[model samples]
Target: MRYDNFPDHSAALPEVTSTWSYHRRSSRRGAEEINDESAVSSEGEKEFLKVKKRKHKKIRATSQENHHWWYAFAVVTLLAVATRQVGLDLPAGTVWDEVHFGTFANHYINRTFYHDVHPPLGKMMVAGAAWLTGYQATFEFAVGKDYTPDINFVGMRGVSL
Candidate 1:
């Protein structure tokens, strides 16, 4: 059966512990984590809050510190160039396979060539390096000179490497 005048609805059951509103200063904050009324009364809760704030301060300090990555990048780039230069021209002197190829290259440049064993491309490649180095005396030196017994293992490898 229903009453006509503002049919009486049961009142909302009262909560045993009232919910509290927490003003979140940060958007990332979660819902009311502690019962505020009980939290303020305990000494342990105060110490907990202080510790949390100190950890947050440490995070802020690290975030605010300045760093220079460009200096690191510049140093690394310079080292790369130096390394390339050192390996580019080394031994100043004769090598093994360099002995063979360098000889053929010099021959072709002077038009006094041995019939190349491989393809025309092979002889052409040798002649190309001679042309690139401007038929320099060093090209002849690499082919003709007997090494003076230094580790100059790097001598011929220098041109290619």
Candidate 2:
């Protein structure tokens, strides 16, 4: 008998149906496929986190570079000020172009007319500084001549710088 009239053919043929391994194998394969998909998604998340961390590290490095540049600028500025201030009062008098510029400054304070080869703005600055510092604008400027102790040429030079 073929058992075609049976209401449940699997129930009547339990041994043959139970021995069929295709259903179990298909179920196991489906479970493995789900696991593989989940593993791939987790790995992708890990990679994305790593990339984000790398970007953060780059930002930190850039910030550190900016700090370094600011520190360098500060150091250079301090060194320049120290260098410029060194021996500022040693000469105690006019040197180099001071003879020309200083005379022009004096003339400016006295309101006297003068002609200059260079622009007058620099002389005006010197004259303004001298006037602010209580200089009477009577100091004679000659090359290699020492300034009097009463004159605060250092203060004037500081203002010019």
Q: Tell how far residue 94 is off in model 2, in angstroms.
A: 2.6
Question: After superposition on all CA atoms, how large is the RMSD of candidate 2?
Answer: 19.2
Candidate 1 stretches with Cα past 4 Å from truth are 1-86, 120-123, 136-161
Q: Name the candidate that leads on lDDT.
A: 2
- C-alpha lDDT of all candidate models, in order: 0.52, 0.71
Tell me the lDDT of model 1 at 57.
77
Among residues 3 or more apart in sequence or in different chains, the pairs in candidate 1 whose N, CA or C atoms overlap within 3 Å are none
lDDT of 2 by residue, 1-161 (tens): 87677586566764422212323433574543122223333555445445545665743466667799889999999999889888878777688878877788889889998776787787788888788878898889999999887778886787565
Encode model 1's per-residue lDDT on 40-97: one tens digit a residue.
5446555555565566674333543434566778899999766766753344445445
Error of 2 at 82 (Å): 0.8
Candidate 2 residue pairs in clash (backbone atoms < 3 Å) = none
User: Model 1 Cα displacement at 155 (Å)?
Assistant: 12
Question: Per-prediction TM-score, please?
Answer: 0.33, 0.55
